[model samples]
Structures are given as structure tokens and as C-alpha cells.
Target: MRELLANRVKTLTPSATLAITAKAKELKANGIDVIGLGAGEPDFNTPKNILDAAAESMYQGHTKYTPAGGLPALKKAIIDKLARDNHLAYKPNEILVGIGAKHVLYTLFQVILNEGDEVIIPIPYWVSYPEQVKLAGGVPVYVESTSEQNFKITADQLRNAVTPKTKAVIINSPSNPSGMVYTREELIAIAEVAVEKDLLIVSDEIYEKLLYNGLEHFSVASISEEVKARTILINGVAKSHSMTGWRIGYAAGNAEIIESMTDLASHSTSNPTTTSQYATIEAYNGSQDSVEEMRAAFESRLETIYPKLNAIPGFKVIKPHGAFYLLPDVSEAAQKTGYTSVDEFVTALLTEANVAVVPGSGFGLPSTIRLSYATSLENLEEAVRRMDNFVRSKWQD
Candidate 1:
């Protein structure tokens, strides 16, 4: 018999966005004019200063392996950033850098989760959270939220989802897909329940610096000392600095938990690229101008696109407080088009309108779709116009 892949590997589902992107590519290859809005990436270049740092490191021969946890100076820079930006003190030893925020999250799951342990994940979560937990032999308990509450679950929801097997709770604010930022009061209330349940907190703050409309991002760890001790704060320079390819992400938490995650990293994919570490150090410590410039651009795009998209017949768009994505509730459109679900609606949009948007089924919200406005303003306007025509022609039937 042919060799079989590991059962754990088989448990993973293919990324929904990648699937849609691949189909878009196939259509484009056949000379189709497809507007890809399904991506979760920032359409910006790595800043010049950070690129220069990476090049300098290469010339300086810093390509050798440093440590599994990461280079000392890079870790120190992370610690300094945590303190300076988030007002949270973290020792260098408490910080571990990995290939990306996703990498760091997977490593943490492998280190802490045992078989059958349950991870409390908010529904409409990032696509990888549940799959990562399952890969680590844990079960994911999803807590659903509705658009009425801006797609955020209440504290009571968390309390209801917990059980004796609960191990961790993930909090992603300025969240992917929905762009929902939890308020300080909301976070504190969630922390109270987590403390009572003795659950670990995985705070994904990758979009911390991408807030719009003057909304601030609060680190879950910064709420209280007890929460800080229990939280593994995950952040990276990807969304904020348009450094997605640099592949630098880190987490800081209780020294023991951090050490365990670092040890796990030691055995698997030891230290992330040395050059990437050096570049990330520059990103964390260098000028704040680039971040501000990008944030301003994103805010402007939001202002322009929100009303435009909302004006489309049968389309309902939520005003996101942060991040560059707008998740439109498209169930009405689905019903109008006789599509029955968002997945079918998105497929029809792609096939007929040449617009690629990710269906919400992957994020546990089956009646919505996510559109990334990270593209140029002209492209955003064109995308909505094309989608509007498609809805009016097809949905009006």
C-alpha cells in the first residue's frame, strides 16, 4: 500500500481564501478581468528602511542560526516595543519570535494543548484557529456572535462555552474578516470570566496599529497584571507595516509558558530567518511615519467605500472601526438571487461580475462575505460598481 499521511495532517481543511484565489487565477489565465478582493493582505511594499536593514544584515553575514527563541537583540527590541507601545513589561526571555503570527500561534498550541483539550474560539474567527487547535489534538469550541452586536460574543457566551476540558481562549481585536475591536469594558469582562475559569488567553493583536476613526487597540495583557500573566500576547509587523513577507511574529507571557513554546520552536523550524529577525527589529524600533501614512490611507478608503457599497441594492455593509476589510451581510442578496447561501452568492459574483470575495462560511458565519479594501481607491470603486451591476442583474430576478 502507498504510504499514508498522518491523520493529524488530514484533519486540516484547505484555506478558503486560497481556494477562491486559485479559481480567480485560473479565470484570469484564460484572459478574464478578475478583481481579486478576497485577500487578507495589505497591498503595500515593505518599507524602504526595513528592506535596507535586511540587506545590511545579509552583507554583515548575519545569516547563521541565532537561537530557537530568536536573536537576542531582536527579542530585546520586542520587549522594548511591548513596554513602549502597550505599556506592558516583558523580559527578553519571555518573548519568542517565529516565522509569522500564524507560526507563533501553532507553536503555542502544540506546546500547551493535550488531546481533547478545548480551545474557546470566537466564531467568525480567523480561519486557522480551529484547524491549528485540531492539529495540536485539541477540540475547538466556537462561540457565535451576530451582526447586531458588531459580531462580538458577550461574556456570558464565553462562560457558556467553557467546560472542564477548556484550555485557552483566543481574542483577536481589530479582527480579520469583521474588523471588530473589543472595547476596554468588554475585554475586562471577558478577562474576569477567564480568570474564574483559569483559562489561558491567546491575544492576537496583529492588527493593533491598523485602527481607524481614532479607535485605540488595547492589549488584553495590558488590562491587568493577572491577565498579563495568563495571556500570550501575539503581535507582528505584518498588517501595520506592510511587512507580511518578512515573516516575523512574537508572543510574550508567563516565563514558563514562553519557555515551553520556545522549546517547541527549537525542535521544529528553529529560529525564524536571521535576516527577517534583523528586519523586524528595524520595523519595531524605527520611524513611525510609514505606519501612520498607511493607516491614513486605509481610513480614507473606508470612508469612500462604505457608503458606496451600502448603496448597492440588496447589500448591507457594516462600518468597521479598524482594519481594511468590510464584511457585508449578504444573506439578503443571497435570498434575492435564489442562491440560498453566501458561498453560492460569492461564486456567482466571481463567475459573473469578475469580483473575488471570500465567503463567510469559512469563518463560521455563512451569510456574509469579506472584501479587502487594501487595493487602490479606483480599484475599490470599480469592484463595487461591478458587484452592484451583477447583483442588480442577477439578484433582481
Candidate 2:
């Protein structure tokens, strides 16, 4: 037999979030009571108007392939959305709509990176960032963010991470796992560092609409012409309109980079599903009522669950301002409960306590765990209670 695995895949770690969620599903299928807090998507169904749009498109026979980049109408809708929401302007030639934000990001990396090039990633990042960078033959250089820093890398930290090989820096505001939304000032500082370093800025704003406590989302690309010139903004209707399955996400940036991504996507995904593109057109152009409704539901869940999660013995949690996850420092809890590490504690939660969460080791922060509030309030509360009881029952105090 010959060796077949590529170096790209041999080094890749499977998504920890999905792995935990799958284990919870398997347990649930066996008639166990499993509370899964590992999923990253919103629990709401795709909005009604978007669903109707998809059905109507099918009836209207809009099932044929769209342009490799996207349907022009859909691209126009996305352009209008960027202008309306972020005060950012982009031409059609500067946009590349791919299968989803993840795919769009993957394509962006493919087009932007060369072998041995480095991309600076902040700590506790979304799991796929580093993997996608490596898959595209780029090095992932990490910059740390402490809990005291609200899990956001400062301009100085970013400046310190840059090397001659540095090609880009990714900023995911309303960050996954951390749920930390960077303020306008924070983004400006990071953008300034990118401008200084002549680095590409990959701004992921998928959680833009899910911000809470009257906090508004800011686009790092809008910081300045200098910043926008270097930025490749990644976003989609997935998180905003509960359209995760729609497979529609777009990136906006330099025309040459966008064209290269489009060329690559044409050979890869062909076109994003035409029907889902129609749904996303509605997602951007239709009523935003459901978007807010879902955001409010998540907000309520976070408020209700944060205190309970913090109350768990030896758990130290900082309240998140946006997004739907709570990343709590549970190193003390793990130690107090006689677990050797957070990973062990996470496994015990799944097998013994019927709760499943992604350990922070997956996000490069081993002292913590991420709990999503995307489920129903009832489930969130019960999950918290189970975690509380699980810790107390094992408390070595």
C-alpha cells in the first residue's frame, strides 16, 4: 500500500466543537438526557420570509446555476447590505460569494497566502481559522489575549506578532467562544497596526447582527481607506438570519483577490446553491424582524444563564456583550473537582453529567470551556444546574 494522506490533512485536528456536539447527539439517540452547549449556530429555524423566498424561487424555476461568484441580484443585495449596515462601499467586481463564510474564508486564504507565509491569529480564536490558514499553506502565528483584556488582542500585541513572513491578521469581533465584541476604538487600534505592518486584514463580522446590550457592531474595514484597502471582510446570512444551511456567504476586498477567489470557487463549489442564494436574497432584502427576534432570544438566554454558570463552584466567567457563547475559566473548578484538566472535566460532563461543551483547549486556551446559549432557556437553565450539581458532587473542598 502507498501512503495517500496529504501533509495538509495529516496535521489538521478535527473541529472540537463538532466532535463534542456529535457525542451529545449519539448519547441522546441512546435515550440519554444530553444538554449540548457545543453548537455554534443559532437554534431558531431559518426565518419565514426567507423560507418562502426559497420555495417561491423553486416554483419560479430559479434552480439553475448562478454565476460562480454569485447571482448578480444576490451580490447587489449583499452590496446594499454592506453599505446600509457598515457604511462600506464595494463594487460587484470586489465581491466573491462562496458556499458559506467558512468556505469564503477558505477561498480567501487560498488566494492570499503563499507557502511559508505567516498569518497572525488572536488567541481563543474560532477553531477553523488556524486550520484553514494551514490548509492553504500559511503559517498561523498566535497573539494571546487574557481574560482581563476581554480576550481581545491589543495593537501592541498585534505589532509584536508581525514578522517579515506575516501576510495577514484576522479579527473576529463578537468572537466565537469568547463572545467578545470589539468596540470601534479597539478595531481602529488593530486596523492601525495592520496598516503599519502592511498586512491583509481579514475581518469576520458574521455575528454583527447578534450584538446585545445596545452594542452596535463596527466594521474594521470602515476604519479608514488605508484599513479598507487591506481588508477582506467575511460574512453571511448564516448567523444573522438563522440560515446556516443556506450555504451563502460573501467576501469583499481587493478586486484582484476577489477575482482569484471567484476563479478558485468556480472550479470548486461551481456556484452556491441557486435556491439558497434566493433565500439569502430575502435574508438581506426582506423583513429583519426575525433577525432581531432571534437576537433578543439569545440575549435573554445569556442573561439568564451567565449568573448560574458563574455560580458553579470555582468557575470564573466574564459576562459577554454579544454573540451567544459563554467562555468561563474553569481551571480552578477542574482542580477543585479532582479532574486533571479541563479536557477531562469536559468528558466527565458528557459521560457522567449528560452535558456536552467544547473545552478551551480546542480554542488554544486550556483553562476554560465554552457553553453556547443557542438552545431554549429551559435547556440552558437545566444544563447550568447539571453543571452546578456535577461540580458540587465532585468538589474536593
What TM-scores do the predictions have? 0.98, 0.99
lDDT of 2: 0.93
Error of 1 at 18 (Å): 1.9
Residue range 1-397, candidate 1, lDDT tens digits: 9868988898788888888989988999999999999877789898999999999999999989989998999999999988899999988888999999999999999999999999999988989999999999999999989889898988999999999999999999988889989999999999999999999999999999989888877888998899998999999888988988888898898889889998888889988999999999899899979999999999999999999999987778889998889998888888887787789889989998999999998888888899999899998999999988888887655
Highest TM-score: give the candidate number: 2
lDDT of 2 by residue, 373-393 (tens): 999999998999999999999
Task: Per model, state how many residue pairs clash.
Answer: 0, 0
Candidate 2 structure, TM-score to reference: 0.99
- The lDDT leader among the candidates is 2
User: How far does residue 278 in candidate 1 sit from its true spot (Å)?
Assistant: 0.8
lDDT of 2 at 240: 91
